[model samples]
Target: MNDRESKSKILWTLFKSMFMLSACTFGGGFVIVSLMKKKFVEELNWIEEEEMLDITAITQSSPGPLPVNASVIIGYRMCGITGSIVAVLGTIIPPMVIISIISLFYTEFRTNKYIAIALQVMRAGVAAVIFDVVIKLAQNVLKTKRALYISMMIVAFIATYLFGVSAMLIILVCLGIGIIDLIINLKRIERSAE
Candidate 1:
């Protein structure tokens, strides 16, 4: 395909994927990341799993909701600004429409016990999905050094949950440590090569 045509196709795919994610992801944006992985990595083959996690991390650290930001970055990577616009629009539209509709009859919906139960069930499912995503990400991190990454992950979890440390601080500290470790590893490899 020509450049323009390929770009158009990529934009359309991003739009459709984001729309589906927005519509189907019930609990929150984290669940959408799992859906994005299935659509982008498994189905479209647009990005690798590691790239998705990196994009997710960036999205989390930046302003705005995680899924929308992720879609923007992914779309931009695939096409450009236009792709980002399409992806953002698609991600926003479904939730906006759904929320509008729900708000119209929210009182009635709120009173429905079956609906409430179903929502609770969905919450559990979403939690499981999020946990799965965490495990997958941890596994990827562990590939570099199983013990080290596991230790870092544990420390991060403890710092955030138990010690009540800000997650942003933990992430920044971890990022710095990771960079330093990479530099050291690179030096070691260079020395070995020499």
Candidate 2:
């Protein structure tokens, strides 16, 4: 394919992927990340698993929502700014349309006891899905530093849930530690090479 044709195809693929992710994901951005990995990394082979993880980290650190930011970054990596725009639009459209309709009818439907019970059940499902995603993410992260990452995960959980510390603060601290570790590792490798 020529450059333009290849770019167009890439943009279209990204748009479709983002659309599927935004539509199928019921819970939140984290769940969408798992779905994105399944589609983009496992199914489509558009990006590698490690690259997806790196994208997730960057998306988390930057401003705005995770899924949208991720879509843009992935799209840009795959194609360019045009691909990013297409992916972002695809990710946004489904949720916007669905939420608009739901918001219009929500008040009327929310008062019904059966509907409330159904929603409660759905919440349980969503929680299970979120937990599954967390476990998968933990598994992936733990592959490199099983003990340390697990300990950090536990500490982060306790700090956030029990001690009432902000997740943002924990994330910042972890990012700082990761950067220090990266620098140290690079220095060690460089010195060894020398």
Instruction: Give the Cα lDDT of each candidate.
Output: 0.88, 0.85
Specify the poorest-scoring 10-residue window by lDDT in model 1: 141-150
Candidate 2 clashes between residue pairs 3 or more apart in a chain or in different chains:
none
Candidate 2 matches the true fold with a TM-score of: 0.88
The count of residue-pair clashes in candidate 2 stands at 0
Stretches off by above 4 angstroms in model 2 are 146-150
lDDT of model 1 at position 69: 91
Which runs in model 1 stand beyond 4 Å of their true positions?
A: 146-148, 179-194
Q: List TM-scores for all candidates, in order.
A: 0.88, 0.88
Backbone clashes per model, in order?
A: 0, 0
Compose the digit string of candidate 1's lDDT tens values, residues 24-94.
Answer: 89878788988898899999898988898889888877878988999889889887788889999999999
